[model samples]
Target chain A: EPEVTQTPSHQVTQMGQEVILRCVPISNHLYFYWYRQILGQKVEFLVSFYNNEISEKSEIFDDQFSVERPDGSNFTLKIRSTKLEDSAMYFCASTSTGGDYGYTFGSGTRLTVV
Target chain B: KDQVFQPSTVASSEGAVVEIFCNHSVSNAYNFFWYLHFPGCAPRLLVKGSKPSQQGRYNMTYERFSSSLLILQVREADAAVYYCACGAAGNKLTFGGGTRVLVKP
Candidate 1:
């Protein structure tokens, strides 16, 4: 089956640097999202993208965070300034819609900030 | 506060079948969800929203499918640990810390 794909499964960056996590959602899906999970925590929603704009975003996604569909196939999350707390597993997901229908998630991109 | 409480915290770094047990005190029930997560990996959606005791036996037409209550029959591929979760009336899904299941060789 066709699944959502992400690039650079693991990444390590120095604190205060920038990091970009990328994802390619299922082709037919219409909604996109980003979530994070600390090593010992449940996954938390970061932001939801729709109609080429962000429809929803969590508090964790503050001034340092930004997302864009730079092109038709790539959805990206950019962290302007990485912090120790920013270290976590970032996952990308897509769904036809979010109400009743389900979502498909990518294997995830591990972001490590030193 | 309103949140997703996943219990049974961390387990072995390798193969595990996490139970991902959860419950809710919400006066009005809405939806349920389950997701699997690997160490240093992203959380994957394994099961979607379900009503209390409403998830039917997992009957699969494909031989590779499972048919038990919440992943009824288990397999090695199903060995990624499991979690049980519930979504509130809103789209928020509160996850159980999850149960870790290991498959011995």
Candidate 2:
């Protein structure tokens, strides 16, 4: 089974710092997404990317957040200025079809903003 | 204003079946999904409950406002947090507070 790969399994950063989380979606997948889960909370959608551009984003994805498909296989989420509340587990997912189809999620990157 | 709701935890013995119940308030929801998550790992789609489907030992029954996931003959490895979500507007999913399953040998 092909897997979506994510870098930096865990990261700790000071508040107000910039952070970029990287993901390599499944080779044949067309849609990519970023989701976050605060400790003991349900997962929340952040953004969805398709055709090299953002398709949809939630209110949680504000000016401080941006997503880019920097290359053929790499999709990244950058937080311009991390706040303490930004601490959470960030998961990258990909699907061959629309998101209503099942999505394959990568082992999340734990971001701890201090 | 929670769109999804589920139990907090369930304990079961090995070889027993476990059922997790979920309810949603999203009136426009046409599909539901179930995901399994181990600590420190990404949640994996266990069953897509668009119209009630089964995969391996996992089965899902979906209704307009509620759904349930059944794990048949569960094993120790089946212990994990299970999440139920409803597809909302913009193709995004609103997840319920996950149910943690504890399986005893």
Candidate 3:
């Protein structure tokens, strides 16, 4: 089965540093999303992208955070300035068609801010 | 508030049967999705049900107020954290806290 791929399985960075997480969604997928989960917590939606523009974003996605579909296949999330609270597992997902069809999630990037 | 609820953990023997439930409060929810996640991994879709009837080891039933995921048979490989998510008209998903299952051999 085709899969979404996320780079940097694990990353450690200073609290004030900038970090970029990359994801390559399925070739045919039209929608991409970024989600995060703090340890032992429920998954939280960050942002959703479609047609090269942000479709929806949660309050957690603030000025420090930005997402871009740099190319047709690559979607990225950049944190301008990281905070200790930013440490979490970030997931990337894609769906060929939304609604009843479930989205496929990548393995995730474990971001640890010191 | 709209939310999904699931047990924190469940334990069973290797060959025992287990049912993991995901109940939700989203009144506009049109579909319920079940996902499996191993430790240190991302969530993987197991099944999705838009209506009360669907096929596969995982099945779902939707009511006016909630939904559920029913796993009929269990195996060692089935031991993983399971999450129940509800998707509304916009394709946004609200996930539960997830239930951690441990299957002892």
Best by lDDT: 2
Model 1, stretches more than 4 Å misplaced? B9-20, B25-29, B38-44, B51-77, B88-92, B102-105
* Candidate 3 error regions (>4 Å): B53-55
lDDT score for residue B9 of model 3: 89
For all candidates in order, the CA lDDT equals 0.66, 0.89, 0.86
Candidate structures ordered by DockQ, highest first: 3, 2, 1
Cα error, residue A30 of model 2, in Å, equals 1.5
Give a tens-digit lDDT track for model 2, residues B30-80: 788899988877788988856889999999998888899999999999989
Chain B alone, TM-score, model 3:
0.82
Looking at model 2, the pairs that clash are none
- Rank list by lDDT: 2, 3, 1
A best-first ranking of the candidates according to their TM-score comes to 2, 3, 1
TM-score of 3: 0.94
**Which TM-score value belongs to model 1?**
0.77
What's the DockQ of model 3?
A: 0.72
- DockQ category of candidate 3: medium
TM-score of chain B of each: 0.52, 0.93, 0.82
Index of the highest-DockQ prediction: 3
